[model samples]
Target: MIRKWAMRAVIAYFLFGTAMYVYLFFIADTAIPQMYKGTSADPATFLNARELMLSEEYSNIRNLLFFLNKPYQWLFYYLILLFGISAAFERWAKKTSKWFSLQTLIYLFWLSLASFIVTFPFAYTSYLFSKTYQISTQVFSSWMRDQLIDFWVGYATMAVVVLVIYMMMRKYKKRWWLAVWVLSIPFSIFMMFIQPVVIDPLYNDFYPLQNKQLETKILSLADEADIPAEHVYEVDMSTKTNALNAYVTGVGSNSRIVLWDTTLERLDDEEVLFIMAHEMGHYVEKHIYKGIAGYILLTFAGLWITAKLMDLWVNKRGKIWKVEGTANISSLPAFLLITSVLLFAASPLTNWVSRYQETRADQYALEMTEDPAAGVRTFQDLTRAGLSQVNPPYLVKIFRYGHPTMLERINMAEEFKQQVSEE
Candidate 1:
């Protein structure tokens, strides 16, 4: 009777969470659009507005790429339901004369390998689309090499995660979730600190900014904002893609600003300065630290929720699924499937948190630079260079976008101009 009640509670928990998320998504989708949808700062007001005009061929290609991935997302779920990568890996690992940890290592290795193989078609299709649109300039050999590197990186990361999970399971079976959540904080920070120095360099070359004049200007801007001003890095992205981007990465001593060569080549000095100021704004606002804090909180919450859901699910379906426990290894795909479902259902809410931070960063950038016109021009450059949809459909914005739409950002710049004029 108690188990039955627990099951009912889990179901209720999921349903209530889903309903709440849907309601919030609806609210954001409806309310936020009216603020900027047809405003004067709408990208339509700017020439080369990506959303306003496109050749039919380009439009068809863009729309096809946009919608093609929706169904492909289910490939992960379907593979779990059908071929069962986790089950196969677990069963195969157990066939060896290995200890439990060894079995887990082997299981993880195979799972990662299987994941890469299973998803390569989707990756290839996406790559093809990027190539078609002149976004990706990478040669096939280079792309394949990157793919292999990515596989190993994923395998290493997951190995640590799975090993820690099982270690906690063995050490503190009753409340291992709490322990895992605690450990994740430091691990996440360590990743953030090392990512710029360690992980990113594995794929791209990064050199100190060669443009002495622009570097001086950027350092001046950073100094004004009380940020670290040395060591601006330029990534050799033109060798890989035509997309323009700049970002602040790492934390503390490892923090660095990296700009793509394409961005430097494509945008003029004023526009580039506006973009750099935006990146600086992220640091000045302590967004990196805030992001870590958010991750820490989400870590505990996600692990706790997963623990309950996994326990309930395994209890109900363990025998049928040929899985003994949460740490059984065969149960991994089920865990992944459940967590993916939870995340997918909750994406709008999560994305809203990211959008809020991005919007804050935009406002801060405007204030720090005091160049509303330049800010507006930066977005215009962004649209043409990145081919970003000016106003993505509401559903896409709610679920997929981590930043506010182009129109929303341009509107922010316009509002800044108005406020400054009034002052």
Candidate 2:
């Protein structure tokens, strides 16, 4: 009893201490100045940062929405942890005479549904805020449908993961984490390969970009970058979002360059080319493949850590929480919570790797297009369209910003111009 209490106290201490550090040190006010200190360049004409600055009202609203959304998200997750939802669900699931997989599936379905229900108001409020701010064009009905689609996707994915997890646990008994980590490799790749074709289309319509002139320029860039594609696609995101985005998706035959309609419609041709070039650079450099390799290593480490930590946690609290074992359906939430905490703690390291890849892609865009000014302008356009913070604190950059900040991107473009000039 004493040991159990002691372990719980330690965990509680670690969890809260880490949370406070991450929030205050990583997520608190941290945006550096737009132009680097000691740099005497007018980055607007030189680097394109000045035009993207939002009005005070828009900046505050965007920042406010972001700040509000984070806590709302954490509240739901915390409620699940504070309440004995996982153990209770497990006990209830055991009462059912269904197959173990069926029981797990049912429990997961309810969990997903309940999570969506609890979070919907907060989610809708976010959408309302976006709409009010002219950032989201999605109608309530379309948004609800997207939410429903999201639930299905999440439910299906969870069910599959849970089934595989317990199956491995039952079979291996002890080395299940190793097995699951191995399984995550192919599953992650498969997910990426299918997302563009199978999953993404459910949320938005995609058509080949219709501007023949721009299409030719993009294909020319792709050719120069040696990216093979059927064609670039334009997703009708403007139907639902005033925010702009574009990306390279999938791998191999499934690979595609998908531009949000908002992106195509909002930016000038040079800016659009820069955006496409950046995304295309992902393929030219094969970041996805490299990311998968990195992900495999990360997963292996994370799962090992999780298994060790969860073993200690459950050893002390299993009886109290009423979770029978790691194999129990009720333990899923605990597993999720543990992983969530671990992932949060690991955010800075992971975010840094992502930012590095993004920066590389940015560099590639500058080189491939030979258009540093346009590349800088592209980010400026994105900042206005997406309401992205121009210069988030370095700590926020370490934890939350997967891509380089607008300021950093502009700085990169400035540096690129100097490099080209020396040539």
lDDT of each: 0.76, 0.76
TM-score of each: 0.85, 0.86
Candidate 2 Cα errors over 4 Å, as ranges: 1-83
Root-mean-square deviation (CA) per prediction:
6.0, 4.4
lDDT for residue 28 in candidate 1, whole number 0-100: 28
Backbone clashes, each candidate: 0, 3
Tens-digit lDDT string for candidate 1 (25-68): 34323222555645655555554434344422343345444434
| lDDT score at residue 391, model 1, on the 0-100 scale | 64
Model 2 Cα lDDT, one tens digit per residue, 248-350: 8888799888889888888999989998889987887888899888888888998888788767877767776666777777766667777776777788888
Colliding residue pairs in candidate 1: none
- Once model 2 is optimally superposed onto the true structure by TM-score, how far is the C-alpha of residue 42 displaced, in angstroms? 7.6
The candidate scoring highest on TM-score is 2
